[model samples]
Target: MDLSCSDQSDHPSRRRALAVATGLAAGALLPPAAATPSAAAPATGPAGAAAASYTNPVIWQDFADLDVIRVGDTYYASASTMHYSPGAPVLRSYDLVNWEIAGHSVPVLDFGAKYDLNGARGYVRGIWASSLAYRPSNRTFYWLGQIDFARTYIYTATAVEGPWNRLTTLSTPYYDAGLLVDTDDTLYVAYGNTTIHVAQLSPDGRTQVRTQQVFTTPSSVGTLEGSRFYKINGQYYIFLTRPANGQYILKSSSGPFGPYTMRQVLLDLPGPIPGGGVPHQGGLVRTQNGAWYYLAFVDAYPGGRVPALAPVSWTSDGWPVVQLVNGAWGTSYPSPAVPPPPRQVTPMTGVDTFDGTTLSPRWEWNHNPDNTKWSAGNGLTLRTATVTDDLYGARNTLTHRIQGPTSTATVQLDHSAMRDGDRAGLALLRDSSAWIGLKRDGGVTRVVMVSGLTMDGNWNTTGTGTDLASAPVSGSRIWLRANADIRPGGPRPGRFSYSTDGITFTRLGPDFSLGNDWRFFMGYRFALFNHATRALGGAVRVTRFELSTP
Candidate 1:
């Protein structure tokens, strides 16, 4: 419905902050020591060890505007992309431990086509917190997507993976709508921060029955959004993300609209970490083991921007509380129940050496890229093609995974041999507009900057800079460090610095506050570009592309 500080203390501050949970776990204070770290399991235990289950966050990612649902035999979750390409990626998992990108909900949102905009690529677009519902009576699944600030539409199919049919577009626009199916088979649609509303949907999962009723959100968070329903023992629990605070749930004994009472802080900011913080979105997970847990996003500074999982235990009373060791959860938690002899695919650990062959999954382009433009063999060659427009507008560059905030990469450029129109460089990009890149033009490596790219295809820079030579370049391992800090009252600046030898470093003379523009762009990835009008002569070889956290 409506919208809305930080400190560096230590691990598990002595004090505790508690919100009420009525008729649920009432007045029960589960102190930090309740789930205290013990000698049984070391603070740093073998990741996913059995003992780790009792205390740790379960889901970690930038799954903003998160929505979780359980379909037949699987748990499906969809979140809004800050800057995700390829559309709204749906993650599927059998036990919530192992996750894989099953597919996208909408095949297209007309980024490059309808908009005629310069870089009209569909990496991540309008689709936000989409809700999935299965109408068992008709053997059908309903998917609702919100775009353009509350414009809502419904798509339905016989299966989750669709040959779907567009059902109807809602005249009422709600930002992030949550869908709930009542025990009587009545469908309730909830909007953000405003009066929580409900409506009955046609059995076919297409049309609506009548106008909706309004249930006011409790006056804790000014604008209440992200409202979902859960019927626990005849009580309707409305789980909502409380703007600035983490996820909280309210319970009522009556119908969808009721005089509900707030019960317990299911998940909140788990204190703070070195480069960033750990917090949860308003997402819940009920596992096959009859155990219920909460899934939220954790920012692990240069590492975890994606979603992470956390287990929640019910108190003797009906309330829920997140389990954390040393009073909080960390990244490596007990692995979820492995389905007897679980299929094991080792998680990718460190930097990938782009050794002339075999492109890694971590490597991705902004959009559908021409395969011929890049040569994986012969030392990662990227040829600059004709550029009628700046390469940033279109998807012609190459980028890799952002390991951490403070990481470094080195690419050998043979620009002296490069043709006139061709240009190649290493970029530290959050998006097209808020990025810093070093390119060799006219036989010199210059530092080019942009504050953020505009919809009209222009860049805003702090200053009119043409070169980076005045800055320090100490070694062969060129490094870019993104410092994450939180400030109160004022904007916390995310500082960017660079080093040539990977040892001695020099600040780029200014700090750039992390902007929302990158949310659409998402995580950091490096790219080699050749955007010259004429084809460049020599190929560019990117080597020692190692990322290290400073």
Candidate 2:
């Protein structure tokens, strides 16, 4: 796997350079002709009006490690969720630009006891990188993910939004694997980090029949991973990313397991934000109109890696090139010619009423949640458990991704059911976490603000916590909100605030700096947690969660 550069020692210098470059590019490329339109604007075309156009980052929220496939006129994308379960999120789009969460490949990542919050931890372990493919032979969808130390798992579903079956797990680890089902119905897997390998899978796509060394990236290529295998026009192409050189494509006319030739398809593309890295680790897809486009992600920290869309053109020699504006990555492009359907294009971020029987698809558990410890009736009820003192160990910590530029998340919590030693509140969860919530102590409930920072090596859990602020609360029901300003500036700080009436909010604690801890390998997320520091049998009822951005 290509580990993120969030915590690297040279991150400061690299980030400064990236920021300058990105600003210049955006100023130069983005104009009236290439406008970055609002996502709320309807993407519609009258009977024969111009196709609706959209800006880059088709999906604004953190939809990282992207792999996209177009079947007929519909487009489906699958991304890496790391340890966040309901892991492998699959998003569907009528227009390649607008997408909504169709479903997830698995409801819970139940690979081992660690994933279930037993003895060990799966913080940076579960579901590293994933590949999603649709096989025309059986009309089945296949999803593959690397479980780090464990085997590579294969999941299949008849429908994209599944009822997926975990068909089998292979003993051999296919690091950052890419699945390709050929025209002849032969299954192939291409994977590796420094050294790339190709193998033939069984007809059932379960076992590896044969393996061969295809190509190894030169030592000069800093880190090469995230492989997307394709057979276009009878030629085999494998898309891989090198941190220093951006994304490259390996071409082979010989076979799937090839002595391939490589070319840099996307090179030195400007990062989406200032202080961000280049965009990479995504696949390509074609529209019904015979146009091609590449979908990739930029390493935007404190908000996770977000996806970017770019138009693609094939040269006369049969190589695909990402279109660049002003000699850099383009931020806005014309929408595909395909007419978008009448369906509404929903943003990934929205309010969760907690009125439904099941959690919204927008919400994901910190790990595989303890199902028995949670329920949804009139609201979301989370029973306190004796996990570790840290929020990392506490299960049933429901989280949603924080949006970019600026966003705010507010949740109304009913702590009346909470017992002594019960702490229930809203948290900004990442490798480092902070929360403002109600803590019941000595028969008194107080509004307390706590912040935890993880040291360099101790990313699996919170290193230490400090009490930032506290105040006495007379009522059991309280509202907690986090305002995040992640736009290009100095440090991206999240302001924590509390409210009793839900209309007026009072700020709590100092500005909380959102750190990009490499262990979590994700952006800061809004988390709802209820845990017991002393004893169990405590509970919190969350009635509403509202998210807003501007």
Candidate 3:
């Protein structure tokens, strides 16, 4: 790689004015001239028509605790998907700036029965931080992570779009683990928080052969986790995050198990979005042309944590430096590799008309959904999988990350099949959540808006949420919309609206203030749900799901 730092320009264009939104989610990095409104905060560097530059948080959707790797001319990223079935989403990119859904590493989150959400629950407790690695020697990709701090599970596939199969389940767990395959093809894992340890894996990359407690945090730095192990220039290094705050590096000239030295890579560097958290907790990669870059996530709550890309340069002292402008992390930087426009790429946020028999790979269930109860054809149909008054307890809710900074999602739903006590519509899914849907009760159908729903200590449904507004409706079909200002600050509210005809909508009820808690981690998402409080035979047909940003 062009490993030298002496010539790399950390200074971006002095004209770092935020441009208008690019175009929805995938167009986040495009120049404004070819763009429309987007959920992403605008690209902040030069807006020249031919300029090849991109803003930070290159992906405006939440793909938290991400790990990016490059193979040949292609780059792939796999991110955390707690409680979302079809969990580990694999994203592909030609140029590091723009990304699209390639497929998934985990087709179904089947770690336990609770994930089914039948009579149990698994919200905010499934897949957390994970490590994604490629083994060219074996022509395989391996995804490894611990579920709920239980046993560690490793999955392997020949391609990113996979028939990924479970390789093994280690009885022991490795939290926030980072995987490394040395030049000699030896496997290693660095894990733990507050204290760190390195483990060497057996030849097959399944069992732990040897382990060592390599380092301990000094308390002054508090804690460090989210590990990403790497070997460069004959030296062993481990990249870790102090979460929602900083990034650190541990260098071991010895081996993967180290007598290591430490250095701070970045700390509390302001994110591209104002009032957002720092860029940390992710991985690093080098473009085929040898440009090094760091792919980290910024905590942009309400919308969740999103990935940002920054150029990486090495110091004469042999440390990696994330380029900065005027002592702060810049909002935009030049595209690391100039490649042909994206191909066979599905936008992370866009319109899905449900024309095909199978749903797009971008859609994930709120949990391990009852696949037997849901189908997609003329429109996506979701049959009530469970009877529950609590939305969290309801099964078969399909969801996708919303666009960031700002975005809107609209869905056209045919609720004629909704039976008594059935609630079907669109929602902004989070811990403290809200929704606008058609509720059928006592032979009468009403359009209702519900808000202020919060989960309790055990994530059980504490309240059904407040009904902000309601009206008896005659139409069998209705349109629902959710407009969100997820940009960080105090109480950014996501509002709800509805329409009987598709032309206009009723913007009603008080604003549903977005949540600020980072512990929930997945952030807010736009979800389509239909559940019966009485029986399971009710269903809703979602004809269109259109996502837009402004």
Per-model TM values vs. the true structure: 0.64, 0.90, 0.90
What is candidate 3's lDDT per residue for 1-550, written digit by digit as tens?
A: 1000000000121111110000001100111111111122222122222345687878888887777777666777778787898887888876767788877778888878889997888887777777777776798888888776678888899988888999988876787777776667777777776588888889897798888899998878876777777776666777777654777888888877788899999886877878777777767676544456777777778787788887777765557888886777778776664445435455667789899997788888998988889999999999998898889888998997888888999999999899999988899998888999988989999999998678864677777887889988996889999998988875688899989899889986888889876656677889999999988898889999999877
How many residue pairs clash (N, CA or C atoms closer than 3 angstroms) in each of the candidate models, in the order given? Answer: 54, 1, 0
**How far off is residue 425 in model 1, in Å?**
4.0
| Candidate 3 residue-wise lDDT at 459 | 79
lDDT, candidate 1, 406-466, per-residue tens: 3344444433345444445655444332344445445555444434433421232223223
Clashes by residue pair, model 2: 19-275
TM-score: model 3 vs. ground truth: 0.90
Output the better candidate (1/3) by TM-score: 3
Segments of candidate 2 deviating more than 4 angstroms: 1-52, 455-462, 517-519
Q: Write the per-residue lDDT of candidate 2 for residues 249-302, one digit (tens) a residue.
A: 788999887889988776677755566667677777765555666777766677
